[model samples]
Target: MSTVATAFADSSIMLRRNVKHTLRNPTTMFNAVLFPIVIMLMFVKVFGGAFSVGEHYIDYATPGLLVMAVSYGLGATATAVNDDMTKGIINRFKTMDVSRGAMLTGHVVVTTVRCLVACAAIVGVAFAMGFDPEASALDWLGVLGLFVLLAVGASWLTVAMGLAAKTTESAGLATVPLIMLPFLSSAFVPADTMGAGVKQFAEYQPFTPIIETLRGLLAGHVSQGDAIAAVAWCVGFAVLGYVWALSTFKKRA
Candidate 1:
């Protein structure tokens, strides 16, 4: 087989291996999907009255909550990659004829799948709780495209973090930013309502554009400018994460 085909075969094997690990560990999904739902509940039940965005509170907040849940999945991705690295599984592969990049590729692919699953779960729960987005089919398609870009960028960044960590604990810490970023962004509230410093940061940060784009798409108010910014952020993260992850994997292996 050609090198391309061999790499695909190797990546498929690695994908299955990592996916089984994720399935065996249900806590991974719990960690990835629960907090966001809890927060969603709190916002809807306790503070839902105080928030308004020209629509129902759930309608407005669902997009941001979904994005946060998906982003948080990277924490699990990072930890899993770290486990493989520190547990000598990667070194074992290095000693064999396995494709060098396949391990990371598999982790990334599975992470994306998990994130999508989390998104689906959160959306379903939102629907059950009367969180109707009222979006059209094409709009849902657009949101899905946004998620693909987001998963690509975030999973690769997680891979890079996994490669950089010296231990699994530190790997967890390394991705704390991923978990915390949504709070500081327009994920829960409008950036313009924030304090000046925070507003500026929230307006410019990576998650802001992504969340805003998701919001706009779902709400049927998408502006071309925000869409452009979101795509740019996705591309930037994807390129940067890919280069960092590939280089680090090569160095570590």
Candidate 2:
């Protein structure tokens, strides 16, 4: 077979295996989907009016919750990688004739599927809670594209964490920063509403631009600057994560 075909076949097998594993353990979806929806509802009901950054508090939260769902999916990737490592699956794969990129491709594709499902659930819950989309279908498509890019980039970072983690708990715990980033960014309220120091940080943070980009896309507003920044950050992180993970993999092998 050609290299491309071989890689595709290997990645397909890996993706199928990962999906089966995820289906067998529905806890992954529970945490990635249910937890985010519940948290979004709780925050909207309790603190929505108190922090009136927008007319529809739930609408303001929908994008952030979606991003959180994508972020949460990274934890599953990390856990799966660690579990495979512990079980010597990585060693077995190394002995195969598969392309090196196939392993990462499989995990990334599986995580992307998980993120999409979680995102759909979040959107359904948001709609049920009366959060309507003000954007056009094309804009929504752009938002989904951005999210999928973010998911792919974040999966790489989780892979690096998985390779570096000493234990399964560590692999899971390593995603805390991803979980906390939205809270620290402009997800909940405007950066101006934060204290001066926090405002400064939030203004420049990666998640702030990402959230702003998604918000603008959902709101049908032009947000070229935020969109550019978000994509740049995503690409930068993906490259860094890929380099680091490959180096680590080589050394450990």
Candidate 3:
């Protein structure tokens, strides 16, 4: 078979395995759906009064929580990759006739699907909480595009972590930064409200541009600057991550 055909087959098999694993352990979906909603509710109910930046806290928080969900999902992906490595599954695959890109493509595709499902759940919960998108369908599509790009980049980074981790525990622990980044960005609150140093950092951070781009897209505004920045960050990260992960995987193999 051609390399392309082999890669396609390998990716399909890996995707099927991931889907079955997710179905068997429904907790993965449960956490992906619930954790962000819980955080949204908690923030709105507990700190809404203190941070009265908007009429409805949930409305203001929807985008941030959505991003958080995507970020947190990377941890689960990392853990799974690490487990596969530990069990010699990756090594076995390496010795097969699979294409070199198959492993990375499979994980990235699975992660993208999970990201879409989690984003849909977040939108449902947000709507239930009276959070509405003021943007048109095209704008919403733009936001979804940005999300897919971000997920692909993040999955590569997590794959590298999985390859580099000495243990499963470390692989799981490496995701803390991913989880915390949204909070530190313009996600929960505006950067201007933070201290000067933090605000400066937040303004330039990757997540800030991503969140801004999403918010603008969802709000029906034309934020070209933010849009450009978001795309730049996503593409840059994806390329860098792909290079690093491929190098690491080859070395380890």
Across 129-233, the per-residue lDDT of candidate 1 in tens digits comes to 887675688989999999888888888888899888999999988989888888898887788789979999999988888888888888877888889998998
TM-score of 1: 0.96
lDDT of 3 by residue, 1-253 (tens): 8777777888898888887877686677766666777887788678766875554667667778878878878877788877877888887887875666777677777877888888998888788878877889899889889988998888888888877887899998987898888988988788988998999989998988899888878878858998999999989878887888788778776
Prediction 1 global C-alpha lDDT: 0.86
Model 3 Cα RMSD, Å? Answer: 1.5
Ranking under lDDT, best-scoring first? 1, 2, 3
Error of 3 at 217 (Å): 0.8
**50-124, model 2: which lDDT tens digit per residue?**
897856888888888888888877888898888877778888888886677777778878988988898999899
Cα lDDT, model 3, residue 251: 79
Q: What is the C-alpha lDDT of each candidate?
A: 0.86, 0.85, 0.82
Candidate with better TM-score, 2 vs 3: 2
Which regions in candidate 3 have their CA more than 4 angstroms from the true location?
none
Model 2 Cα displacement at 146 (Å)? 0.5
